[model samples]
Target: MRILLVGAGLSGAVIARALAEAGHRATVIDARAHIAGNCHTERDAETGVLVHVYGPHIFHTDDEGVWAYVNRHARFRPYRNRVKSTAQGAVYSLPINLHTINQFFGRTMRPDEARRFIEAQADTSIADPRTFEEQALRFVGPDLYRAFFKGYTEKQWGCSPADLPASILKRLPVRFNYDDNYFFHRFQGMPEDGYTPVVASILDHPGIDVHLDTPFVSDMAARHDHVFWSGPLDGYFGYDLGRLGYRSLTFERFRATGDWQGCAVMNYGDPDVPFTRITEHKHFAPWETHEGSVLYREYSKACGADDTPYYPIRLVREKALLSQYVARAAGTGNVTFVGRLGTYRYLDMDVTIREALNAADAFLHAVQANARPPVFSADPA
Candidate 1:
């Protein structure tokens, strides 16, 4: 089988590897000159620090299979993401942990006492929280929400918290304990070299041909036995219905001597601060020693046609547009949508790989059974 795997990100790389290993020819291509997509990383020419060109992507997953799969391609160094946020002229631990709660309130309360205190501060009247604002108010109360979330959410998403969905807030965990680990996963690590090499390793097989800077077009779908698209959902259809809403990021990079910010990620929760966070590249790889450091001041904005889409704003309007695209994709033969952009959802690295693996497996299974593969092995809608 000749497979056209579009977008040389994790999704494309993983699927291409699987198909190639199964003796199928896979042609992988991306409009970008790189392979890792948003997870692309490279050593800075000046500082010799491994910089996450897009942003910080700490690989943390509970799935043993996904962990093992990545390990097979590249060596992973144990890395825990400890994020800090500056709000009201003071830095505090993220995820609203016990220490954060205590410091914000200027009192050293025990875990139980802190929990009770927050409950008291919470709005008891709002039984069913619908929006992000309501959810935060119910969980962490007004004071904490204003200090930590309100300003940050407004800057990050470029919208009022009241307009955002409650599910967005659900992604964050508020711990009553002292643990400041950003993610609660069994496996948390970073590739020793960088993500680009990891993805390159995946596409190294002889059965797979990679064409960087080559953008896949709708007309090319007819030339392949099957097409696996990992590009934007609306992009695949030429945005006939309408463009889906997405948030894009712009990085203001600067070089400095020694440590900058003294941490990998330091977010500014104050709305007054234009950029949301500052990421010190050297801090991401603590094992590597460097005299100078590189930092990126990240600013989030509404995604434009030319801009790279980061997070999908799946509000009611975007969801309706996505549904139209999903329907059109279903009717289109010899093509299957995969990955975050195709699904119009914010997915972790592990989930993306897991789903890509499944999609490839399903395609192989369909071949064995002499049946036509479904438009989506894992439904994007």
Candidate 2:
């Protein structure tokens, strides 16, 4: 069987590798010049710091199989993401932990004490929170919400918190303890050499052919037995139903001598501040030390026709448009929509790889049964 993978990211690469190993010839193509999509990483030419070209990607997941899968390709060094935030002229730990709460209010309270104190601050009136603003106010209260969440959410989403869904705030958890690790996943680390080699190793199979800087055309699908599209769902259909809402990012890059922010990520919660966060590339790979540092001040805005889409702004309007696209995708034959963009969801690296593996398994099973493959392996709904 001949397989066509429309993107060279984790989803496409993993599926291609799985099919290639199963005696299927896979052809992987990407519009970008590089292979690893947004996860693409390379050593800085002058500073030698491994820069996450698009943005920072910390590999963290609870899935044992996913953890082992990445380890097989790349050497991963133990790295925990301890994020910090600057708001109202003070630096505080992220996720509104005990330390952050205590520091913000200038009160050194124990776990139980802090929890009780926060409950008092919360707005008990709003029983059923519907919006991001209400969720934050109910869970953490006005002070913490205004200081940590409100401004950041507004800047990141390019809208007032009242306009965003409550599920957006539900992603982040508030802890009574002082543990400030951003994620609670059991397996957490960074690729020792970076993500590019991990993906390069995956696509190195003899049955696979990779083409960089090559865009997928509509006619290309007819030439292959099956197509696994990791590109945008709207893009595959030529955006006839109108463009899906996405928040694009713009980075202002700069260089420093050593230790710029003293952390991997430093988010600005001040609405007046233009940029959302400043990422120190050197901090991402703490195992290796270098004299120079590379950083990017990230700014988020409405995704334009030319901008690189980062976050899916799945507001009411976007969800309606997405449903139309999903229906069209279901009707289409010989193609399976996979990955974050294809499925129209913001997926983490581990989730993306897991779904890709599942998609490949489903394809192999369909082949065995002499049946048609699914349009989507995971339900977008």
Candidate 3:
């Protein structure tokens, strides 16, 4: 089979490599002159810092298989994400650790005492929290919510926390202990050579043909035996049902002589601040040292037609639109929707790779059975 894989990101590269290994000729293409999509990383020529061009993507996953698969392509240096946030002219540790709670209240309380204090501060009246604001208030109390989450959530999603889903707040945890590690995953690290090389290595199979700076047209699907599209789902159908909502990011990049924030990520929790976070590129790869430093102040807004979409704002309206697209996709023949954009969901790098592997396996099985490949191996809806 001649497989046409659209968008040479992690999803496309993984699928292309799988199909190629299974004796299928795969042609991978991307509109951008890059391969890693949002995870694209490169070296700063002037500063010698490995810069995450899209944003900071620390590769952390509990899946051992996915971790081993990534390590096969490039060296992964141990890097733990320790995030700090500034709110109301004060700096505090993120995820509301014991130190953060003590520093905010000006008391060195033990873990149990801090837990009791937070419980006392929490609004226990709200039994079943529905919105993000309610969840924050119930879990961490009003003071912590306002200082840390309210402003940040508003800036990140361009909406009030009351309007957002409770599930968003569930991703964050309030620790009674002093552990400042952002993620509790088993394996956490960044690629030694950066993400671009890892993705490039994935697509370097013998049966795979990569065409950078190539835009995938709808007509191109008809020319191939099968198609694996990792582009936007609404884009595939020409947005017949209205455009799905997404939050896109804009970076204000600058260079400094010495260390700027002394951390990989420093989030601004005050809504008064225009940007969400400032990520210093040099801190992401602590293994290498350089005289100068580079960083990006990231701002999030509603995605425009020309802008690259980052987070899927899966609100009520967007979910309805996604369901319509999923139905249309199911009826569409010879094409399988894959990846974050194609599935119209926010997916981490590890989940994206796992799904790509599963999708490839499903395709190969279908080929052996002499059956038609399904529109989606995993349901987007």
List where candidate 2 sits over 4 angstroms from the true fold: none
Index of the highest-lDDT prediction: 2
Q: What does candidate 3's lDDT look like per residue over 1-381, in tens digits?
A: 889999999999999999999899999989998889989998899988999999999889999999999999999999989999999999999878999999999999999999999999999998999999999999899999999999999999999999999999998999999999999999999999899999999998899999999998878888899999999999988888899999999999999998988998999999889999999999998999888999999999999999999999998999988888888887888999999999987788999999999999999999999998878757776
Clashes of each: 0, 0, 0
| Candidate 3 pairs with clashing backbones | none
Q: lDDT values of the candidates?
A: 0.92, 0.95, 0.93
lDDT of candidate 1 over 1-381, digit per residue (tens): 899999999999999999999999999989998899999999899889999999989999999999999999999999989999988999999888999999999899999999999999999888999999999999999999998899999999999999998989998999999999999999999999989999999999999999999987777888899999899888888887889999999999999998778889898999999999999988889999999999999999999989999999988898887788888887887888899988888899999999999999999999999988867657655
TM-score of 1: 0.98
Please, what are the lDDT tens digits per residue for candidate 2 over residues 1-381? Answer: 999999999999999999999999999999999999999999999999999999999999999999999999999999999999999999999877999999999999999999899999999999999999999999999999999888998899989999998999998999999899999999999999999999999999999999998999999999999999998899999999999999999999999997988999999999999999999999999989999999999999999989998899998899999999999998998999999999989999999999999999999999999999989968877
For model 1, the superposed segments whose C-alpha errors exceed 4 Å read none
Task: Sort every candidate by lDDT, greatest first.
Answer: 2, 3, 1
What is the alpha-carbon lDDT of model 3 when measured against the actual structure?
A: 0.93
Model 2 backbone overlap count: 0
